[model samples]
Target: MFDIYLPIAGMQFNALILVAIGFSVGVLGGFFGVGGAWVVTPALNAFGFPMAYAIGTDLAHIFGKSIVATAKHRKMGNVDMKLGLISIVGSVIGVEIGARNVMYLTKLGIAGPVVRYIYMFMLFGLGIYMLYDYMTKDKRAAAQAAKVAAAARAGLAPPAKKSWNLPPMIHFPASGITISLWTVSGVFLFTGYLSGLLGVGGGFIRMPALIYLIGCPTAIAVGTDLFSVLFSGAYGCFTYGIKARVEIIAAILMLVGAAIGAQVGVTAVKYIRGYGIRLLFAIMVILAGISVSLKQFQLNTASQWMVMCAALGMCAVIMIKLYQGFKKEQAEKAGYAVKEVKP
Candidate 1:
């Protein structure tokens, strides 16, 4: 069904399939501030991509996609450069350590299963937890609103800082917060370690961690995560490039699709509510878990079907959301124009 050249993955792949995969993952990466390697690598492998080339090609595309997404997000005032740089520093160190550990595990002959199981557990557990959080989000929002009212009535100062206050505090003007350096480093290091070990951009982990742990706004979390992914993906590309795993031609095609998809996704973010984004993300991850499980059980065909369907389904939802959002935004602008003219 496809053709290949040495060190190049599926040079003759169904061009539509490759483009679709690239576009879908690009949208996800833009929306979630991740490189989407977790999805792309597996999808490529399922579609006859060389195992070695899959990851490298995925990373190569990710680097390009991240650039597109980050640039757009930056214009939208979503990126926090200070936090992003810190993430890079911590993640780079963590990645080295994690990679070394993986090498050690590989020597024991249980590395493959161990890594796969860990990936599965993380996906399922994170999915469930996010779903639960989404279900209870309204209650939490109401409680916070009540707290704000009570504070206003009491004439108390706005909420006090509750950050852990570990040493070496760093302030981020863009994010409008100050956090302990230790907390920042520790969080990025852990996420970075996961990235290296799992051969992912760690956007899933980093984005969630940014929202819940670092306490960044959802938009900022997405932007900052993408910034970090750019660096990590570049490093990955280089590593795999030296090993002759990166297919430049395939990566170029994917990059074109990703560029367009990233714009759609970044624009959609402006229209969607934070909770809505979280809900969609939870569903996507849960389905990803099912796909991974199928793969783990040696049901390659089933795994591919599940993943492709899930991805296509989710992509449809995102595009629809983006369309609706664009329409609504446009209507509001038209109304504003009419009002100004009347006055």
Candidate 2:
């Protein structure tokens, strides 16, 4: 069972660590409707795994986790099968190009810095934007509510419009919106490229894009994102595996843990509101950005402690999110009981 040792590193197989990492990633993945590959790849790299092996192993684990999450989301009627299928073709092509670029960068001895820099920029930028958006939205909601109250005091009704005026709009029975296909395709292309470049499941980006850009409801965005990730991640894993880039044992161990974690995450989703999900996701991304930035420092300074710090920070974020999710679930249940007693 421990036959495949890392001769260069002089380390034996540690199945327990792999399982723990997988389980943690799975919980985050399910809760945020993400693939969790971002967490897995960096964590593995911190453990002294080569970049190629880490990415491949992470992909395999994501493939399995995606399957579980997608199934759950599908049951909840969140998946848009047609859109997911179309996105798969684009995701496959993007992954191939991105994987090739990774190999090229590795050969040039610059992959680590380049990847870390990209991660730092993307994560931090997105995190800031999401945080800003949430804050502005809260203010806007408060203003709107106040306006409505004033109108009631004046004996006038609030606005009756339940829609907006967006051009070239077409109705989506699933989303119940008249959004443009151009908007959808543009988002998917970006999502596909990001998934390929970062070796992530792309749900982190896709969920927001779907809700904000495409005007899908939060539940639909989460569900549809999982459907897209299921295919995209499987394709990525297969491509990497065929190239012998995958570590099957590591991937399997992570998947085993992720499977259980995914279930817990999915259950927690029932209790979390849309704004709450966005806030949690933004916080996670910011922490992830910090972790990747620390990794960049490790690479530049050749500091083992920095690398360990990055790994610990990331794991801490995951664990915190998981605890918060469970807490939210419990709070919701307690609220229900209080409501029942009130009546």
Best by lDDT: 1
Question: Candidate 2's residue-wise lDDT over 1-343, tens digit each?
Answer: 5335544334566777787778777777776778876667766776678888888878888889989987887887777776667566666666667778888889999977787787788889888988888879978889899989998999999865465445666567777866566666666777767666775677777788888777777777877788887776777789898888887777787899889877766656665677767777787788778766765665533333443354345445555665787787789999999999996
Best TM-score among the predictions, by candidate number: 1
Q: Against the correct fold, how does model 2 do in TM-score? A: 0.76
Which portions of model 2 miss their true places by more than 4 Å?
1-11, 89-118, 145-168, 197-199, 298-343
- lDDT against the true structure, per candidate, is 0.85, 0.73
Stretches > 4 Å off in candidate 1: 1-11, 148-161
Measured on C-alpha atoms, candidate 2 has an lDDT of 0.73
For candidate 2, the per-residue lDDT at 261 reads: 79
Q: How many clashes does each candidate structure show, in the order listed? A: 0, 0
RMSD of each: 2.2, 5.0
